[model samples]
Target: MKTPVKSLISGLAPVLVLAIAALALPAAQAQTAAPAASAAPAGAKKIIRYAFRIAETSFDPAQITDLYSRTVAAGIYDAPYEWSFLAKPMQMRPATAAALPEISDDFKTFTIRIKPGIYFADDPAFKGQKRELTAEDYVYSLKRHYDPRWKSGNLYILENAKILGLSELRKKLIAEKKPFDYDTPVEGLKALDRYTFQIKLAEPAPRFISSNFTDGSFTGALAREVVEFYGDKIGEHPVGTGPYRLAQWKRSSRIVLARNPNFREVYYNETAPEGNARLQAIATKLKGQRLPMVDEVHISIIEENQPRWLAFLNEEHDLMEEMPADFAGSVIPNNQLAPIYAKRGMQMVRYPRADVAVSYFGMENPVVGGYEPHKVALRRAISLAVDVDREIRLVRRGQAIPSQGPIAPETSAYNPKLKTVMSDYSLAQAKALLDLHGYVDKNGDGWRDQPDGSPLVLQYATQPDQQSRQLIEQWNRNMKAINIKIEFSAAKWPENLKSSRAGKLMMWGVGWSGGPDSDTFLALGYGPNKGQANHARFDLPAFNKLYEQQRGMPDGPERFAVMADAARLMVAYMPYKVHVHRIFTDIAQPWVVGYHRNIFVRDFWKYVDVDLEAFSRSKGAAQ
Candidate 1:
């Protein structure tokens, strides 16, 4: 729960972000300022209400890859291992405070130390008073990612050629050998002791610590019984040792959680020194305090935009994740939402984190049934016609970075020296390209025409969300001024992704996201990966060659060069028209505390120290 040193934003900056100290305010101060409760149950547990736009697609970690479910699941399970956010890159201070296993200087053979006294979610089928988590349980969980039957999209974490025998284990799973035994043995992982584990990688990786233990989106330990019964169902029925437990998942309605007393007490000081030294510090700072300042978290499904904003205003919800950038001026200026505006709140945190802003150009290839063979030049011309900087200033309202290529800003692979493919919006240049491609407005109907005299019109599909709709509408206007008629179609988020990947889309809204590693970004441009989900399906041999080489190289200046080469190819081609990477912000009610937005700290409530008494009163009045 401890905040780390602040990070500075790179690319187009001298911007210095500051690490914010916790706000100095007593719970009583905020509680007393609120309206009187309607009718109070004398000692009801505190309930924190939250709002999310999309219902979790599923709860199984193997399937549920979005931000929503991961945040919720962080609470319900306990891993044999945990990470400390306060530690620097490549180092994860243990949750149990046990001696760290010795790792080689090159990071080839990691000797990990496990902390004792951790337990998984209690289940009747496990046949135990309490299921204690052991090092063996972690071995089972890590191996599960590679199981062919599971087909975890995240298996890429271990899919690299460097993972010895993983390919063989995957083949065995397909043949139904139950590749790794949860009860007996795990093939690639081993338990050296009751509280110690070891993993053998085919090669040294400098970012292993960031890739596995500390990062929230990556692997963590799992309970054997929990995985057996739940199996693939673990996504929805996540059972973890975090601060909260799954109470209800009402499908498209809402997901609920109840605080775990066992975790609250244990994780209270897990980040600090252990034994008497930790106990003394905990007591002195908290004044004989216990764990878990709050009792429950209730996530209300708000698929619509208006409801989400109003719910936060009326205090019906305690938190708002990823506030709409267009509404920032209106929402952040309000006194009730000031907590999000403070230095502590606005400070951007990146984890192997890269900028979220990038553009997806629909690179049409005649070989793949793309735009008409004659329109290839037109597609490339349209890509260059976009004015990304203006798009950021106008559509984004100055909250994002104007992107120039497929690669996100400030990432390890981002190439600063690439020849700018999208510079200066020149209408003359656009007109010349159109003329060369045999486009002309012969009748002067304010619309371009093909050689055979058909109108040059294309449809751009996008999500129906308010922000997206607005951006698309504006983009239509931008293209129209140039006599290129564009039809904007709105579709559901999931369906839109499907349509884009299937190449049913000519052009649409697209964004790039991934961890710090270059491979994460490579998936979008790699020829094979591109054919699958990358909407543009840009098949560049040079780009694919570099992406493969960058993955195995240890983190260093050389790897940077390799990744930069891949990025340069993306910029030069202009596959998708560049846009801006807007900063994502989460807003919450005054009483909702102890939540860190760190991607590594999956469960905000684990560190959550909320005002329970006030939360209970709020919920009672809402009912």
Candidate 2:
């Protein structure tokens, strides 16, 4: 579940009625539906099985925004740069590029040269010809986001970078109501030659390369022919030059990926960070092994918590990506793996996720949205009424820390020492604020009315799930204490997301995961990023100025100062009531080798291997 920090997408799973049906089925019966784990014959294929709590939206790099879809796209597409899998301090390494990008002294220009001989996965779009990846492919890929036809959710990220002429070209085409001219040359983004491309920014951007180009899922190169061939259906038919290819897709149920026979020869040679014994051991064991050690990767979308947990426990899946908070006390008691599972050779990796769960108020909505004093007071009063500490203890099961502002953890701009009223919970203050703003019980009704004596019912959008229900119950209690009327509109995650981006939903609570760049979280409040990364549509000029001021300055105390001021503006406006930064616990079975969660890296499947012998033994022991 990738959130809107990068593109305003939600990282939480959307519960479906199908999940309820799965819950009714027994664990053994559910396991029977999945691929069997029996011992394979000689020269058989090795498979690594896992389950996502949410379903993927699309495979195309330009269109998809969710975490599950990006996870699949990361394995299939090759970006110029990628995060080092085993690095502790988080370093960037060349993926398809020949070397690190050559940056100008001003940090306004970046030149990258891609390695030759890399070819796309064989597809009919190429007319049975070998489609070699070139510098032009990246140029065209970046241009795709600007095209009005695609309505890309990630357009704001590139637009914020202010590439020299690319934004101008897009604006010209959009103004003329003409088709995007892909062949038109742009000064900012250009293919220098056969293998080299350069990007010139309007202003200095020290972290642009690492922030935008490092993740293949966000800026992966796409072949022009494939995009033209698929057209409207391009998202369903993704063709790329990577370690794996999509073998099967069952809509929201299952997805299968097989090793790409045409993939380049990539070997496991990651450097382990010093003093980290676990990574050193993994590096030593996997060195020299061919990339994507597994022959096939099987993924299932299990939206319900118990069924997804049961799938991992029943060995239907090899890894449980995120441990459900409902079972945290029993599974990983006191932040340690339970003895019962530890004795079985299960591995647990616990870390605080770089994300924030936020409930945003659409600034354009009539009921809860406005910049005026009274409207601002209404939102702030509501924020103060909600108890974040209670939500963390009861709903989150103590697996989260209250967030003070928009900045996520593990970022250059993040200051743990900084505190504000973003997480304050006080019913008395909330009531007084509302009373001061003229919101009172009019017509003798129990609920508080608007200052104009109209109904002040809050329409909140939410998904149907056990966790969501618990969170909503907390909202009900909080609103009741404040004498405010609130109503929930239940819908699927995807539907709610569509409504959210369209600004149709008055309020929706979702989590946003931070990307490699620290500026991503703050983009949620940027004025120009409205309806994209800025789901709240918070258009405050004071905050926007601070955001732009920090973008040019190199990461330092000065830039941090600007970012802190921007975060303060976000808090003062109360467009988004940021709740908590969650702590995640992922568990892997004994047979899964090189299993480690990298916060900055999305494509970890290539570095992991499955121990077939150990898997077979585990099955035998179970019998």
Candidate 3:
């Protein structure tokens, strides 16, 4: 992934928050991060209440791709490697692994040693024995993705990287009608001893570290005993060696995480990179501090933005993350917090959002997919017509930057000067491109016809929310300007995701938060990822070849140059029209200290601290 471009909010403070004086906010259904609690009201309860607009679907990252799920899993699990909580560039450091993996010169074999003395939170499956993490646990955890029964959505990463004999082993089990034997070991992935494990790849997968192979806590080890213990209900019962463990869950309504007493003590020892002088200064305050300052985390799921925002305003939430863009001006007028919120000790911190919101045209769908001129022209015309600039101003309320290509700013391979016609908003050019492809009004219906004189209408899967309605209206207006007939079909994100993967949805728009490498963006168009990561179902031999070549190479100009060629090819074909990179504002109360959003990380519950005494005093004064 490309390094994120730091979005500068000219007058915003460098500190996450020094203080927010407000009445106590309820802990849930409003919003939810940062490291250790700073000095506040004496003896203040160290607690943080956060909210999310979308309900978390599953606790298993292996089954789900939504941000909500990832957020929940981050606290419950631990990965082999984790991004620094304060490191701006997000260097991956050791988690369960003792150190970075020892790699062979060919880069195909990676040997990792698990840290000794690490143990999972106590679970019933332990059956009166201590549950310690082992190399075999990691191997079993990884193999979970290949179990055809679970239908894990993340198997693509492992398969693409070609982890030794894993795929062949999974294929053999599937073909032979035999259950996967956890006791049986595959040579490609094996535990040489209790503490050591090795992974041999069929190819030189340079991005193995950046990919799902070793990133978030979700990729942490799994106890086969625990998985079998929970059986089909594993999603509800997550067992890991992370800082917190799931305590209470009322699906779609609320979740409570309690500090894991069994967790080994870990502290925050990160320093911000050189250029970010402000973060570096803040880091000093938190350095050497034993982590998980907050005692408990309460999360509420409020799907509607109106109520969610209301909860924050009512002081029922400690932090309101990514304030709804629709009411941006009302809350943060002219790039400053409105007097109403400012006087209440709330401040707006605009951070560079590390994601790209893109609308992809399914390349395999009959209406939109093809290498032929008519299909390609229609895709190109639609891409050129979408007014992403208008989207930035009106829909996003200037909280987003128009995407230049697949890679957004703040990631690897993200070139600011790379040219692409998809980012060019032009109605005339769209119409001319259509006309050139024989797409014109053959009848008097005010809509263009396909080259075969058939009525042309495109379907887009969309959400039923007000924001989506407004966005679809914008699409209609833009497409109307180019005489294109487009229809919208409403569905929830999960349902839309199903249709999209099945190649049933012709067009849809969604956000992709890239990992720590550029391949995260390029894999969108890679052929083998079709029906999986390749939501566009774009199949091109040349693109696939280049994607493979780049994946096998490490991060450098040579690899980036190759990835750039793939992006250029994607831009030319327009399988996905570049939309806008979203920017969000995180607001914190005065008493909330040591808080700042990490551009690409989610597990900070351990680092955040609270001042309940100050909160009570503020509320007492108000009352």
Separately for all candidates shown, the number of backbone clashes (residues 3 or more apart, or on different chains) is 17, 5, 29
Cα lDDT tens digits for candidate 2, 55-135: 888887778878889889988888899888887678888989999999999999999999999999999999989999999
Quick one: best TM-score, which candidate? 2
Point out where model 2 deviates above 4 Å.
5-40
lDDT of 1 by residue, 1-623 (tens): 10001111111111111111112222223445656655536576667677767656655555444556655655664543455533223235555326645767766777667666766666654776776667776666677776665656556556553555665666765678665543444444688888777777776666665455553334555676776777666666676656667778787688888876456245354343345453344334544235455677788877765566556645666776665445544445422344534422322221223544444655663321244534555755665566666666655545666555556543556654554655447667777878887788977897888767777776776665656665666667667756787777877766766566566666666555554455555566676654343557777888878876776578788988787777667655656565555555676554564444544455656455556555566544444
Pitting candidate 2 against candidate 3, the one with the higher lDDT is: 2
Query: By TM-score, highest first, what's the ranking?
Result: 2, 3, 1
lDDT of 2: 0.85
Clashing pairs in 2: 1-11, 2-67, 3-9, 4-8, 4-9
Off by over 4 Å in 1: 1-43, 78-91, 96-102, 172-187, 192-194, 264-291, 333-354, 358-380, 406-419, 422-424, 437-459, 499-506, 516-519, 531-536, 594-596, 612-623
* Cα RMSD, each candidate: 8.0, 4.6, 5.6
Tens-place lDDT digits, model 3, residues 105-196: 89898898989999899999999788888988888888888888778777887888788778888888888999876666777888899999
| TM-score of decoy 3 | 0.92
